[model samples]
Target: MRVFGMQHIGFTVPHLEEAVRFFEAAFGAVTCLETGRIEADDAFMQRRLGVPAGCRIENIKVLRIGNGTNLELFQYSGEEDGEEPLKRNSQSGGFHLAFEVDDCHSAADRLRQAGVDVLEGPTFVDAGAMQGLTWLYLRAPWGQFLELVSMNGALGYERAGGPKQWSPVTGE
Candidate 1:
């Protein structure tokens, strides 16, 4: 079976409100849905993925930015005080999420001005057909990696290196 593109990314947070605010301010994500009573099985899906169950599952909020993907945030009711999750740059299971921007440098600057901790710059990268394109990495509020890439073409089908050539073949 062939795999399609990503649908959404989930993150477990101690405070859903704070997480939502952070994302809204940092990435201009808009709240799409907020529910306090998600099914137990649905909540357990996150636990099945290795999230500790000590925290009490309370609410879930979904936010969407642009038309690419959605961010799912969950908040537990009685989570014990513990160490914060490691930063995206650090060794972690899910590293980070990338957002294509019109101007990486301006995006980084805007994020910094808005009080978000931007790790690196709108540095240039040789992305094949997208040669001389600029890209930058930023740390999200919950230690997740958010990348901003600026290029001249579309998101995934950018003709950076050169034009893609297709050849037709006959099925036997």
Candidate 2:
């Protein structure tokens, strides 16, 4: 058997509407699908997703960024307070999502003009395999760290001896 590319990545959010707006405004994400809810139980969730014993989420939503990856936003409550927004991508199980943009600098500038917090950005890499890459890291309204990256042209490794680079971007 073989595993192919990723379909989507899921993220838990405190507010569904807010997240929807963020996705729409930030990445021009389109709403693909939404669901009602699932019963709160250990067996049901555990068997499917191993989601502890309790915690049945409501208002599950899915957003797609152009033709790239999809973001699955699930609105869940009652797990605990303060955990609504995660901080520091340093913990053991922490992770960040990244999206490939056509022009990294322009994208970052647009984001800044939109009043979004662009933490670090427009960093150019010119030494390694990422030679022609430009990237920026920004925080979502809910504090999730996401990145905008691009290598509009061929990288150093690709020019030298690396395999062909694949892009999720649609339309040349």
Candidate 3:
């Protein structure tokens, strides 16, 4: 089998409502579908979802962000919930999501106005494969690391005839 494109990314959050609201208010994400609370007294939860037998999934929401990406947000309530602390990018299994904006500076300002914690630079890369790109990092309310990125025209690699980078704005 061969891969085509990404369909969605799943995130297990502490509070479903808060995550939904944050995505909607901060990034204009729209809720497209919801699978209400799911639970089982038997081993179905374990066999199917790989959760503990008595574990319960409080809710699942599917949201669409910007032009394309879809996010599947899940909220769980069980004995094992939140047993593991969130990880940083430097740690194993740690990851961050990046959103492409028209202007990185304006996006950072909007995030600051929303009282979001802006972490690192909206810094520009001077002479590299990523030349002309500006990016910054921020933290979501639930502590997920996110990035804001912007690029004008094409990148250095593209200008040098390397493979084109995938962009939501250009659909490439």
Candidate 1, lDDT over the whole model: 0.69
RMSD to truth, every model:
6.7, 2.2, 1.6
Runs in model 1 with CA error above 4 Å? 1-4, 39-54, 78-81, 90-92, 127-130, 154-172
lDDT of 3 by residue, 1-172 (tens): 9987888999899999999999898899999999998756647887788877666888999999987679999998875756687899999999998999999999898889899889867999877888989999998898999998998878888888998867899776
Per-residue error at 58 for model 2, in Å? Answer: 0.8
- Which lDDT tens digits does candidate 2 get at residues 1-172? 7877678899788788998998899889889899978665778777887666666787798898977668899987546746345756888777888888889899998999999889776899979978988989998887888898888678888888898755776433
The positional error of residue 90 in candidate 2, measured at the CA in angstroms, is 3.7
Give the backbone clash total of model 1.
5
Q: Rank the candidates by lDDT, best first.
A: 3, 2, 1
* TM per prediction: 0.72, 0.88, 0.92
Candidate with better lDDT, 2 vs 3: 3
**Alpha carbon lDDT of each predicted model:** 0.69, 0.82, 0.87
lDDT leader:
3
Error of 1 at 135 (Å): 1.2
